[model samples]
Target: MLPPIYTWLKASNAVKAIIGNTPRAYRPGDAPQDVTQPYVTWALVAGVPDNQLSSTPPSDRYTVQVDCWHTTDKGVEDLAKAVRNAIEPNAHLTAIPVNNRDPETKLYRIALQFDVLQTR
Candidate 1:
């Protein structure tokens, strides 16, 4: 997992205000058995973060796959939408939301990819 993504999520008032520091699983293959509902789990889907070549590489660019899980589809979609809104800290940075389901666990999942460019 990219540390910047983690840091952004951790420090995001938008996210915290919505979820209130709920459990965030870094690159988790499976949600923890004891973890509460409407939580977050993420995984590294591709390459490491690349440098944003803005004259002096002042920022890094990367994609983080964020998954929102909940018992109900409504809950999953709502949480996912909140995640999408929360992660958008900048105009150039955005998250694409997709509806999905975990193949193994068969839980409702709101999959999102946050395309980010953060200052170094």
Candidate 2:
């Protein structure tokens, strides 16, 4: 099943303003190398099916890591805020956001973890 994160971000005008409309968000390794700055990438880091007494689980919970990247620190911070504003209404923030600059690429990145529950 597709995660709702992509759908939410793509639908948000704030996020589209920074990342563009065509490619709003990408899977961990799916973004093209030549992708422009102020882009977003996400991955499902973990999942757990709900347990029940007698029937199959009717829902699942997922932990996803979403990362915003840009050449400028302020740009990445703005992108990350947009992403959070889009997803935070439905998903719960699971970890404190972490940011760092890649020494080799000099790209600034901010990573956020969220927990999303989806019905099966």
Candidate 2 per-residue lDDT, tens place, 1-120, comes to 546888899889999999998645889778888887778889998999999999999899899999988889899989989999999998998885679998988999999999998898
Candidate 2's clash total is 0
Compared to the true structure, candidate 2 yields what TM-score?
0.93
- Clash pairs, candidate 1, are none
Candidate 2 overall lDDT versus native: 0.87
Question: Which runs in model 1 stand beyond 4 Å of their true positions?
Answer: 1-3, 10-22, 29-31, 46-56, 91-98
**Global lDDT of each model?**
0.64, 0.87
For candidate 2, the 10 contiguous residues with the lowest summed lDDT are: 21-30
lDDT of 1 by residue, 44-117 (tens): 55544454556655556666688777777877777776666666664233455667777776678877876656
User: Candidates' TM-scores?
Assistant: 0.66, 0.93
The candidate that achieves the highest TM-score relative to the unseen native structure = 2
